[model samples]
Target: MTFHDREEELSALTTAFETPDHEFYVVYGRRRVGKTELLKEFCRGYPHIYFLAAQEAEERQREKFVEHVADYFGDRVPRIDGWDDAFEYLGEKVVDEDVVIAIDEFPYLVAENDSLPSYLQSFVDEQVRGTESMLILCGSSISTMESEVLGHESPLYGRRTGQLDVQPFSFREAREVIQYDTEDAIRSYAVTGGTPMYLTLFDYTETLAENVQSKILSPTSVLYNEPEFLLRTELRNPARYMSILESIALGHTTPNEISGATGIDSGPLSKYLRKLQQLRLIDREVPVTASAKKSKRSKYSVADAFLRFWFRYVEPNRSSIEEASKIVYENTIGPDLPNHVAATFEDVCQEAIWNGIRHGMFDQYSEVGRWWYGEHEIDVVGLSPTDDRILFTECKWTAEPVGIGLVEKLRAKTKHVRWGPESREERFALFSKSGFSDGLEQEVDDSWTFVDLEDLEQMLSAGR
Candidate 1:
């Protein structure tokens, strides 16, 4: 698959390299989020040495590192028993030149050698006054990367000139890569959700069900066991995290609710949720108008769309699921996939609206998210108290066209939202999958925006 939508990240790295000084950059993100790929793309055509670290003994890792360095330089390297000697020799060879030395999976090196940061700190200190070399340390372990290298208490603190936290693509950027129609794009985005690697596994020609069966439902497919593999690789207690994730996937959103579903004690549940949030595997949702620290009604949900789908449709039915079988997908998955995809439709609707605001297509808002208080729930809310403006959107993902009744239902809930003063200006909008009724548009106020999937796609795909 072709690389897509990282102009900002690539531009940042290029800017650091163009400077005539020593530069240290740390690039990190979730697993398979294109950290390595982005780094490689940035390194193209540069005099660079790239070494991928693995879970191995310190001595073996150092040996492999020296070998890669030698292969790049095409010169005989002296014996380097420790990191200090290794870096010293490296500094000696690449003296005062523009070269990039990127160490991928840097957390693995830190894991093997706890003092690896100290050694690198020394290297960076020397490079500061000595060479124009750029050192890029990249990793997938969000916790380890943040705590070990980027944390203030670490030896390498303040050593980095710049950092890149490579993130997943947005729905608009992902649509360019997936190359599917609006309907299937939503389905594919719900499954892949901006993760570049997973998005590439799908073919635009195939239907959503066909793609799901071959790429996800099949036991032999790469993504079939992806969530489990990632959990085991990243966490010490995969089973506990799995239970919490499965609970959230099953629609148990609150701490008490997750505890009730998993039978895990509520006291320890916060730690797991915090850890999952740090890992970017789950999201803690608070009302759009409320602060996270103050919101008592904050809820947890599986942050990764693919993982949510896996936990929802794949994990529960694993016992009865057959490899590469259509029966399971046809009978069970197909029935529920629409509802599953609907949840993401609400998210993208918010995203599209927010992106529109960002691009000056709409009024700027300070926040955009779901706002819920008991029985009153708004699917999408854009609030800017500074501007004394709030926008509410009613998003429907049903097969039939939406009518004025749904519009009226959304208006009824607006009075319950306790935001801004009574004099604040308000806006109403509707986003539908199957479009809206013709008469319904005329019935509603002319100021209101009624957007269907096609318009939403155009707005998003046109660089939202």
Candidate 2:
């Protein structure tokens, strides 16, 4: 697949190349998030040596690195006895010329030899600094990368000149990559969750149900066991993490609820939750109007849309998938997928609103998130604490036009949100899949901004 969006990352690398000195960059993200692809794109025209570290013994990895360095120099070099000798050779060869040496999956090397970071630190301080060489260390293990490479106590703590935590694409970028109509694109993104590899696995030419059945629900599909594979690779005990994730997926959002459902003590569950949050697999959220940061009413939810969908549908119906039965897709997933997509659509709308704010299309806000009070909830709320202004927004994914009722309800809920003083300025924004009703169109004024699917598409395209 063609590279879609990484302009910022590429620009960063381009700036790094202009320094005319040594550059040490650390790039890390989860698997299949395009870390290697980003590095390869940056290294295209440069004289670079790219080495992918494998899960092998230290001796074997060092030998492989020796071969890569020899190939880059196009000469017979002496065998490397260890990492020190390897880095020394690289530093000597690239001293006079601008060259890049990127080691992908650096964690694999560290797994084999725990002192690889120390060796790298020593080499960078002793030989590579003040030279015209660039070194990029990339990895996929988020926990390991944080604790081993970028941690405060690590030997290579302050050696990196630049670092990037490459994340999955945003909703707008995902739409561009998928090339589907707004509604279908939203549905596809709900399952793919902005992951480039997952988006590429889907075929836009096919219907959503057909694609889901073939590319996701089927036993032979690449994404069938994708979440499982990721969790297993990242966690020492995958089963416990699975239980916690499943609990969250099933709507047990609080620590007490999750612990009750998973039969794990809150103490141990908190540790697991922290690890999951660190991995970007789950997120903790409090009410947007909460006074305290650590509110007791905080909730936990799966951070990745794809993982949420998989845990909600696929993992629970694994027996049907293993039996190769179509009923699971038709009866279980097909019936409820629209509701799932609708929920994800709210997220997409919020993202689009934020993008608009970034592009100067909307007024700046101090805080933006969902707001809830008692039984009433508002989908999107952008509050300006200093300016005493609040934007109350609602997102609808239905085919029927959103009438004035939603706007009225949103106004009613706004009264409950105690953000600023009583004289706070208020605005209303409504986003709908279908166009708004005639009554709503007539109600549009300076304070009300109605956005239909077409309007959203324009906003997304303009922001891009």
Q: What tens-digit string does per-residue lDDT give for candidate 1 at 251-351?
A: 99999999999998988988888989988999999998888898899999898889999998899888667643688888888888888898999988988
Model 2 residue 97 distance off true place after TM-score fit, in angstroms: 2.1
Query: Candidate 1: TM-score?
Result: 0.97
lDDT score at residue 116, model 2, on the 0-100 scale: 90
lDDT of 2 by residue, 148-186 (tens): 989999999988899999999988877777868887888
Report how far residue 455 has shifted in candidate 1, in Å: 0.9
Query: lDDT of candidate 1?
Result: 0.87
- Per-candidate clash tally: 0, 0
